[model samples]
Target: MDAFEEYLMTNLPEAPSFHPVFNEALQAMLLAGGKRFRPRLLLAVVDAYTPLLRESAYPVAMALEMFHTYSLVHDDLPVMDNADLRRGEPTLHKRYDEVTAVLVGDALNTHAFYLIANAPLHNDAKVALVQELAYSGGIGGMVLGQAIDCWFEGEKLTPEQVDFLHEYKTGRLIAASLKMGAIIAGLDEKMQRELFDFGLDVGLLFQIQDDIIDATESSETAGKTTGNDEDKNSYINHFGLEGSCERADALAARIGERLASFDAPLRRSLEALLKPYLARHKTK
Candidate 1:
């Protein structure tokens, strides 16, 4: 198996075969393909800070993915983005019906906490992970970001306002994903911060790349409708293509500098992750 695949297989959450609904929900959720960047980053974190923390960080990482998936599911709900597709498949609500989709998302989000809180890892470590996930996923991060995005959509925004919207809306979880990894390994605050900073830049670049892709790629290639942000403010809309490209490059380069401080393979992988954004710019 690939390193990522192995990492995923190693730390699966324990489920009673009897909980058919719960098991089916989880399976349905996981089978949906995502970038898996967050969980992998968490694993990378475990590798860097303390691989010895567990024989498998999979369950913990998967928990984070569940939370993320929950966000996506809800983000596409009728009252939200109102999208009809995801991962090149019918969205949960579209496929399973709205009630099923909403409940499934709720289940995943809560179950994510359960998995990490009850992880076979050390109690202190598991407790810390739970807090991190909650803080990042709750008011501090993804949910708040979505709230802001919804509130601000179809409205005018200044540069700072746009930046704040983007940072909270998308950048927070990206930063948290990295910090969660570092925290899982029990890294000190200073080191954890450095990783968080690195995550912020990379996460920003990821969002910018999405903008560029939306501007340049077709809906078929991107799996979601392109130009959806045409009505919404984005780095590309405000900064324009060339300016966004310049910003993405500068951000990625700075992240590269920070990644250099770490000898860990995960850090190296993150640094390499920037390469795709850079390459995407050229294609655009």
Candidate 2:
């Protein structure tokens, strides 16, 4: 993780223009730092499979983090969640301006592909990484989920509908993180698919835990805005806090069982990385 952080610090996106704050805004959220959850997921798989490629995988991991950070930047914009804080710091929009935030998000989102394209991997793997990231993070996946979430804020959605909504909005990118790692490790198609499916469940549980945190934690404790999803169709909103906690517990259990089924290296790596996070909602 420290090595990953060092790579990010040194390889930050550089855009030189008449604009001074543009560069600063672009680097702000990336430096502010979150859990690096997506990047860590990708790297864990790489470390388990091809330990030698771990360093080479840094750019890919960084790309995932950049893409995720871009989403956070845009999601915190005035028109989205209207969040004031993220990663224990003021959001890009709050620190700079909406225009800066929008452009920074755009830069990070596009540069993610650039990072993958430039990574020192085989051309085919690079292309596959780009395709996976685009497909999962693009319109049919994360964008679709966000579209549904924003469009149906106050409207009641069925539990199934909510699952579908979150699967794309949040789950797809997370699933892609795992899939991308598998791609780098040159895993079989079947293995890749299995990891992707596992990641979807993990992603859904992640979102539920987030909803639980929003309902219960303060902005200071959460390192971001809380109680901001009142208008948003979240698990906590649809099911009361207790119900959401129960759902999270069940999902965590299933995820644990699946984790146990993996081979020793991957299982141990992921279990160590994920056990605390899987039951985070309960902790809150």
Candidate 3:
């Protein structure tokens, strides 16, 4: 396991036997296998910019993972997608109860901020990181996106509307992952914005690929619910499978070009970080 996993295992919430199951539900949802992409992205950005800061980046990375896991837990709730599986295992709501899953999600969301506020970085950096996460995952970001998706189910959204939805719902946190790393590294505002834009492109690509996967793959293969997007406003709904695939490819190429434009070592490090995602576009 990675240091993040170690930290999670060691620091997971503990409770009395009367409510041990609550904490256990949180652990099960969190420790369920995931790609850890957001945290890895944060670490990679730190590594590319300042290797010495890698150690200091762990808490922030874990915070991102926690926030992401919280989102997944809530997304799979009966009130949302009503998913049965996540990461190839029963969803929190499925294994436990709806109320437990809801509380676990809430706990993870708040704990994510606690981790950020208590991270070893300077106070100013911590403040900025917290603001970014709140904006990305809060009412104007992920929540807004989800609300739009839920409200507009079965409605035919224009391409622009679809982009707006995904940008806030899925892209904001991904963008924040890179921007948070830049902030931790003390990079200038210009470089931070550049990285944020790069993250936006990557985020769009990821969502488009996700829509494709939902259409083409199965729940077992994806380790989560599939075919759920068919009734919602999604890239596949607006762009169709072939168009969505082409758009994902185009975005991947754009991101590759952007990475290549950076300085030699930074370029190489960023490319290495993105290799798996880029490879997915090609193989798909």
Report the lDDT tens digits of candidate 3 across residue range 252-276. 8888889889888668777777886
* Cα lDDT, model 3, residue 202: 84
List lDDT for all candidates, in order.
0.74, 0.91, 0.85
Candidate 1 Cα deviation (angstroms), residue 212: 1.6
Order the candidates by lDDT, highest first — what do you get?
2, 3, 1
RMSD of each: 2.9, 1.3, 1.8
What ranges in model 2 sit over 4 Å off? 280-284
Q: How many steric clashes does model 1 contain?
A: 1
- Could you tell me the TM-score of candidate 3? 0.95
Q: Which pairs of residues collide in model 3? A: none
Using lDDT as the measure, which candidate wins? 2
lDDT of 1 at 58: 71
Query: Candidate 2, TM-score vs. the true structure?
Result: 0.97
Which pairs clash inside model 2? none
Ranking of predictions according to TM-score: 2, 3, 1
The local lDDT score (0 to 100) that residue 96 gets in candidate 1 is: 67
Residue 118 in candidate 3, Cα distance off native in Å: 1.1
Off by over 4 Å in 1: 1-26, 264-266, 272-274, 278-280
Worst 10 residues of 2 by lDDT: 275-284
